[model samples]
Target: MNFLWSLFMRKPALRQFALLDAQGRCQAFKECNQPPVGNGWVEIDEIRLSWMHRPLPARARVSPRPAQSSRHQPLAA
Candidate 1:
């Protein structure tokens, strides 16, 4: 059983990278299965002087405020 499982099982996938342009705008954001394309890697002419990291920025979140309750719903006790 162990032999069969090991043969079929593969390694985990790597997460994609996110980048920011010169103007600090999010130019590309996608979970790429393959390596980065042309002028995508670091120290390239296309890439501007911006920060690049494995994880996304904290400010990249979109948490809107809860909508006002038009109807008063009963709370479940």
Candidate 2:
């Protein structure tokens, strides 16, 4: 039974990447099974001067805002 359940269950895939805007600020942190593609975005590992507005600082890091929790939702008045 355990083996059958495992076969049916889908495993989650993990991906970590950061997106920077024209000003070099962290616009978003993406996590998906497949690579994300869009305008004004590039992978953190790749280096492309054309995609970046300016050179990033050596100590620069991408720290996007934390995901909001459902518990914080306001009750409808």
Candidate 3:
């Protein structure tokens, strides 16, 4: 019957790929260059496991400020 068919014919969900670590943790695609402990496809909803694992942009290093002069005395108001 049409009703039975509707119940069984649900739309297929989207598939997502993920890399897992040795402890079964999810890793981001950018970090896939490193050796994997475990790897496989994951559901879209499970993407959160790897969300925080994404590689961050490299930050520029800042040099320390020069030492202040010792003779700089503050004037009284």
lDDT of 1 by residue, 1-77 (tens): 99999899995655344454654445665454444675532222232234343333545433433666899888895
Query: What would the per-residue lDDT of candidate 3 be over residues 1-77, giving only the tens digit for each residue?
Result: 99999898976544344554555444554222222355442323234442545532222112333666789767875
lDDT of 1 at 12: 65
Writing each residue's lDDT as its tens digit, candidate 2 over 1-77 gives 99999999999856555576777755566666555787644445433344344544544444544666878776896
Residue 31, candidate 3: alpha-carbon lDDT: 27
Q: Which segments of candidate 2 are over 4 A away from where they belong? A: 1-12, 44-77
- Highest TM-score, which number? 2
Ranked by lDDT, top first: 2, 1, 3
Candidate 3 matches the true fold with a TM-score of 0.25
Please provide TM-scores, in order, for all candidate models, with all chains considered together. Answer: 0.32, 0.39, 0.25
Name the candidate, 1 or 3, with the larger TM-score value. 1
Task: Tell me model 3's lDDT, rounded to 2 decimals.
Answer: 0.43
Q: State how far residue 73 of model 2 sits from its true place (Å).
A: 52
Query: What's the CA error at residue 19 for candidate 3, in Å?
Result: 1.1
Candidate lDDT scores, in order, read 0.48, 0.58, 0.43
lDDT agreement of model 1 with the native: 0.48
